[model samples]
Target: MRCSTPVPAESDKLKLDWTQWIWPGPKRVFSAIEMARAGQQPWPKSIDYYVYSNVFVLLAINSNVLARGLMHWAALLGLGLSWLALWVAKTLWREPTRRRLNLSSLATAAVMIGAALLLKFHPFGLGPDLERDDRKALTLIIVAVVTLAMISWFFLVLIRSQQIAGRLRELDEQALHLKLARRLASAQIQPHFLFNTLASVQHWVDTQDPRAASTLRSFTSYLRATLPMFERESLNLTEELQIVRSYLEVMQARLGTRLQWQIEVGAGVDESLWLLPPGLLLTLVENAVGHGIEPSLRGGSIMVMVTARPAEGQVLIEVRDDGAGLAAGAQDGVGLTNSRERLQLLYGERAHLTLTPLSPGCLARLQIQTLEPTA
Candidate 1:
């Protein structure tokens, strides 16, 4: 049977949004696209297209070649006026939504329609009076048709712009989730480290430290407590502490009674808080055991302390082990090296885990910058 990995008791805050049952992502994008189309302004090229389809062509079909020439000139003149009017109207009404695009089309459509209306009813429109009322009527009808076409075109352009914007937003959200998952995975499992743990514990069957044998049992417990609670992206302090406890139990077998452990947690540092990076505390605990506790052949105690600094809105954790301490050459140390890299990736400069040696032992202090206040 395939094993179903269980998530740790990190924070309940990381739960799926149980509050609002929102629309699916694609549908939301579709709605945004539709809205953008409704709200967007027109482009200048759209104006040109509208003018070509509406005013110029109507003049082309309904008038004499000479009258059409004058109307074409008038339409060009009106197009400039329309361009200016649209720029002003959009500024006063639509604001900068279409600030960059060519929106001269809106003005062109407006001006051409107005001119067409005037030309249709006015007796002396654009040229000498038409010989027949029928000719004038047909000319008027054509101008009206162009005016309608220009308005319809502008709305269509707005609708298309909205659809494009919605799709872009959807893609952006998807990209963000992929990036978060990548970072989470990189921070979690360390195969070589796991292999080393078994080897290191087994290397000594009956060494002076009788505790080494029992460490195997502690390792087993640590694995049982930690592996089951591992979540995809994050975990709470409560879950992390369980991993730490099991690890410390196994480590006590190596250090024997020489290693004493203490944990002091302040109030309001809630278990459900989502602050620390996954496997961060593991690295800290491991480094304490590896470089701090194991080196002092006489054995030493490790104090894992945690406190809430509500004034600063941060959580401070200290892992102190009374061992030989870290060497200056410890820069090559893998546990601290990997721990620091993981911290930088997850919290940038906001979160920090540092290894410093005391006269008695080495101390790994971790400061989580943000406190997701318990609700």
Candidate 2:
């Protein structure tokens, strides 16, 4: 069953680049020159790998045909199969890295070798048996050479593909990190939040209450202790909640009767769930206080709820404020922007955030699954 919010699903699938599916022409050509640097491949192989791989290609095709039928139907099928087998070996052998032959290459050589031995051992033995065996032996050597070529080609492709893929992944990660850094840097002091907290503190401090000033100082200490958190990569859900609670305490001391608050921590949220990027949970609370509670003028109440389902292995955080609520695109504050980017960086497509009007108030929801150690 779905909860108050439906579980989010991946909207896209991981995909390999289309170009990887096709052969890399330039790479193979360059690799060919490097492969034959030994110059042992006397021009015939140098001209085209097909010269070496053709036999295996042919054998594979013929085998497939034979498996289907040995009758007249298999006749042209066998010949076509043979040609295909050779083609496969020729292409595979041209690359030097695999440094070995493909199935087609080995099978082709085997087929020819088996056929030659069979004829030599025929009960009658072919006429001039020595000369017949001599011809077959020479052909066998050529086929062996081609098989080796195909093996080389396969290895080359494997190595090159891995290198290209690794580079692409690096670039993507770097782009994301830079974006995160920019968002964090722009999130210094959101004046409205500061203005509201400070205004409330000044209102109480003017009354000459030492407890109120101490509370205000404690609140300032909390802000100072937390501003450095944004520079961090991650902090756990428990740690984040602790920070939020400290902030709520500051607001409660200042607003007092003007603001009512509820902080509920669900028992299921295990400390071991995972490390979340810093400032995520706090962002939800900050928005509630900044937009939801502060803007009410007459003031209102906010509920901070945290639920964890350890068995299901997920966590949910909700900040609900019973105030004037919000309009479309109402959650575009700098803190929210920082949070969205941090989530995207950490989970790619897995984590989700939602903001909506809860009839009489505004609700900010965060859901996360698989909070295993990033390391």
Candidate 3:
């Protein structure tokens, strides 16, 4: 008698087939499609098609029993039909007319329902005729409906998020353009500043004082230092302080003994690590001198104090002067208004400029949230 060959075990057969049949073909397809579309796919539009296609394929597959050859063929058919549905959905509903969109959606739903029914019932023996169980079938239909609804909701949320992000980007761009325009407008030295400084130089020159030449030199240096403010968005605290010192030098030449100043920097604060909005500090200082000191005949002292509170995550700068305090119901002038607007634009609500009465003087305080240290 001839020896018979041994047949492989059922478990071995299943193991071999698992890799071929149980793999995620639909997920792979979706990922590949996503890659192919990439940035070319429009938001909201592509999302609808993607969701519809996925839901349709899932419904088609879930409505029938899975078999060896039947499963493979069903998957292929599901993929092809889903792709076709996607193409149609993308092309048909493009018109913004509400009636056309409604019609296309209805047509798509009808086709999907008909195909699902045909596959499940096998009316003409196109596939295996699964036994109909009312309870089980009803449960499956409810699940499919819920799944489709959830998918639609998810895509809708995605569409809304993308729209919000686009709006925010456009606002940022507009703000940036406005910032540039404002910077250009502010680039010029106020005519009165030049006239006053020149008048001081003329007074010195008429008296034949040796400091007249030095005063002109200081004015030139101040102009050179301030020119970069128009070109830069921000400056290091130390650099800004240098600019302020240059400004103070020029002002001292004009004010003579009338302008006395002090600057105090805080401990544990790295000036290089911190940044200031361009021209912000200078504006505050100018406001202090113009509004506080110039009006007083006795000549006053101005104090600039910078402090960082690491525990509180804040940086505080105070420009104070021993001169006249704020007038009651005093309206904001152009300098103060422009400074406030710039602070709001750059820091939103996280930064502010406050003018408060301080005993014999007023304090112009600029408070900003500190940034986290970089890695």
Candidate 4:
């Protein structure tokens, strides 16, 4: 008579199938948030996952085999051992020598392979082979390929994260350089403005003009407003307009009927919420008087129109003059250049300054995005 092969009981087969099916649902619930914050990849976790998952896959392939309880315990033992290697890899991977290719990961894979072999061949001398030859070969190939792919994925994540960190540092350095350029440009212009204002005051006092006291008072107000522009970073539309009014008042006294101006505000504009770079309006007005009006034989009118669009969160500022717009091939002066640099530093592309020719003269239009804090 031929020797008969021993078989697993029906209860054992049911127990193994139920355990494999149920293990996956609860196992996937580990904290992904905590893993990200901790700077950990899911590679090791995947190794732990496959420790149990491989058994299920193997059982599916060999339907005639019944997985013993001891086999499950041995797989858990391998998972615990593989975790030791994963911890070692994580610790050493931080070092420069181990960053690209960590040997500890290879050791982890070796432990997982050993666990698969034990599952296929009964451990502790329990019994004959429960799995068929074809199923065993296929299961080993699947486990090995998955293990290698996970190791490669871990290294790719590390390299990409390092590249991101480097790029962020470069952006921060560029921002600092822009800030320094803005401060330097603003500082150089303040002294030149002060000297010119003083020279005008002396011109009136020395010539013994009867309007000296009134001129002195206007100068005082202009000085008080203009002095702060050198130090301030931003000003609201209302405060800036007041300062510009003081400046124009001083100029009107000097120019008499030769200088005529207008300041019109658009409806529904809340000056308190609208912001502008310091002295931006002053720069445009000064350019109008100096470049446009001063060159004309009879002088000209300077019109400053300020309109705010609350719906769009923008402020439109225009300074126009009736003097000769611009001579052929004229370039931006220091004042206009300084204003442009300040706008770039403060608002990047959100603010702009343009000098366009009005029929006879020039129109300086400045459009800036408003920054109003929420209520």
Candidate 5:
């Protein structure tokens, strides 16, 4: 099964619109929190809370209640408590651990109890005519608001954690599948390749042809370069090119004057500094020879080019064969499919392999985001 392409990294950036303000759903709220955690700017939800609290204060001032001053103070206190709740939620989102959760809960309860006691005792002496029932209702309202906010945040954090775990599992499965595909590709290619080369060598030796020794040497070099590739996950571009060159040389010996090839490195491209999945380029080369060159009456030339755009952090590798173009209703073989899967697993949407039909042939292009080589 083909893996779905991952979302682009830029899609994670917060770009709020009118719809998000009208109804900030869980996704938008979580994105706001993430932006705040990343130390970007204040999230819109925080601004909305402050605005709503001030609006409540205004409504309380305009009311014809007996304890207008008490209502004002209650509004202010609610604002402070809500802000504290938001901070607690942010902290929990950043580090959702049992220890932190317990600490935050204890702290919130302590603050709420202290506030309730202060309101009951009239410590501030701002609302002398406030009644017992009014105080009770006000206290209940504040506690309910704060408690609901906390509950919502806890559930949000829980859901986020579950999503993260699920994504990790998906990645693990993809990695396992990639490994199995690599082994399958190796098994499919090696025996048949060895048999064909050995047959050619045997025929040449029996005919006492002058090309036998050179062909044997090329075959030895190809085997030396190809065997260790399957054991590694990645290799430097220079090493990959070496393997491709060796394979092409062996092919040339077998199909003399029919297969011609060249490798070109563009300026500013340091082949040794760039890395690629093992056998990636060689797979393209093999496909070109098998499908494009060999089927034609007069085989054509193949060119491998490596170019880099450092400013854009992009690398492009093209394998072009001037032979018959893609056959009618042609589909990718196992080697091509495996190569694509490997690239997807390694680079996500940052890398892609595309085959474009040329005027007289086909161009297989691999574009990937460049990474600094590890020391």
Candidate 6:
């Protein structure tokens, strides 16, 4: 069966209103705040929540020395400064260079100095009545508040930097995987392979051979399955096996009786439940045909097997050929290298691909640990 790609309807496309373009920043900020409040972590218990709460408590405790209006103004100013500090930390996190870090430090120092000046001058026209001892105490309070703000800003920047680094690493891995997928697709559909297959089809057609129609059908099916396979991140074993079967059939048609192949599934194996990186199995089969069988004087049989181990939570796949064994000092080609890297990216250390040389042939085995279906 062929896998069909889904296309979204016209109504499914994103349609933005005028507010989305005009007030995008505020809308996104509010939306994010709402999401944070509704998330698994309690918003009230966050570090920022505690920090701001402490600042307000300090302002309220000293309300006797300062006017009520002045206290409110100071509270608002502190909140605004905290927001600015957070914005600056996020900006620095995106591009954490030495120069940016130095500049942010200077900016933070300037903000603290400005806050002290505002408090001393009573800019809100509601000055605090204080004696010599009271002034000293107020000065100490300002120092403590500044120190707290500075420490909070430092920790905020540190946390943001770590988060940004992890996000960037994930993006880099995804980009590398996509690059390898495209390269493997190109390698599989090389001009020489296509030209050779077409040449065989043309000969059969010219000689009015009966195999011409079936050969063309298999070639069409192979193209239909392969063209869209790499566009996706993964495929179920059933869809991948269809591609493999079509490929083997086309090759068999070209080689005539010299090429023989069979696919075997263990009794408990459900092909649809097993998901794999696209074109992974196809690469192994191609290796078997090109390196293991085609190069030999008498082309031999290729066996593809899929077995599931429910108790062990693993799936084993093997592609074996009773043809020429591995040549001495032969390094892995682009296909095998790309396959290994793709497997590593997908399954980490839980999946392994090994090529063992038998007495008369070569065996390529792949074992993947998977308990549930991962699509």
Against the true structure, whose TM-score is highest?
A: 5
* lDDT (C-alpha, whole model) for all candidates: 0.60, 0.62, 0.66, 0.65, 0.74, 0.72
Per-residue lDDT tens digits of candidate 3, residues 60-179?
Answer: 666555434344454555455455545544442221222333444456567656656664556433333443442235335434554354344334434433544455566668868976
Question: How well does model 3 score by local distance difference test?
Answer: 0.66
lDDT of 4 by residue, 36-91 (tens): 43334333456547645655565455443435544454344434444553555445
Model 5 C-alpha RMSD to native: 11.8
Model 5 Cα lDDT, one tens digit per residue, 1-375? 889998867856665565534323233233444433433322347645664666476446534442565666666666766677777766765554445655666677787788789768874554444576567756775687667765666575565555544555666687687777766665445466678889999999999988889989988887888787767777789889998888888889988999999999999898887777778888899889888898888999999999887766889999999899898888887888888887876778889899999878999999888565334
Q: List the residue pairs that clash in candidate 3.
A: none
lDDT of 5 at 152: 61
Give the least accurate 10-residue stretch of model 1, judged by summed lDDT.
Answer: 20-29
Per-candidate TM equals: 0.53, 0.56, 0.60, 0.56, 0.66, 0.62
RMSD, one per candidate, in order: 13.7, 15.4, 19.0, 18.4, 11.8, 12.8
| CA deviation > 4 Å runs, candidate 4 | 1-127, 130-161, 188-193, 203-233, 309-314, 337-352, 368-375
Give me candidate 5's TM-score against the actual structure: 0.66
Q: What is the lDDT of residue 125 in candidate 5?
A: 56
For model 6, residues 1-375, the per-residue Cα lDDT tens digits are 999999987766865566533222112111233323332222233656766777688777776765455456556665666666556655544443344545666667776677667556653443345333344445556566656655554555455445445555666687886877655653466566678989999999999998889989998998898777657667889988998999899899988888999999998888998777778899888888888888988999999999988777899999999888888888788878878877876788989999998767789999999776544
Q: Which candidate is the best by lDDT?
A: 5
Q: Which ranges in model 3 have alpha carbons more than 4 Å from their true place? A: 1-176, 372-375
**Per-prediction backbone clash count:** 13, 21, 0, 0, 0, 0
Q: Return the candidate ranking by TM-score, descending.
A: 5, 6, 3, 4, 2, 1
- TM-score of model 1 (CA atoms): 0.53
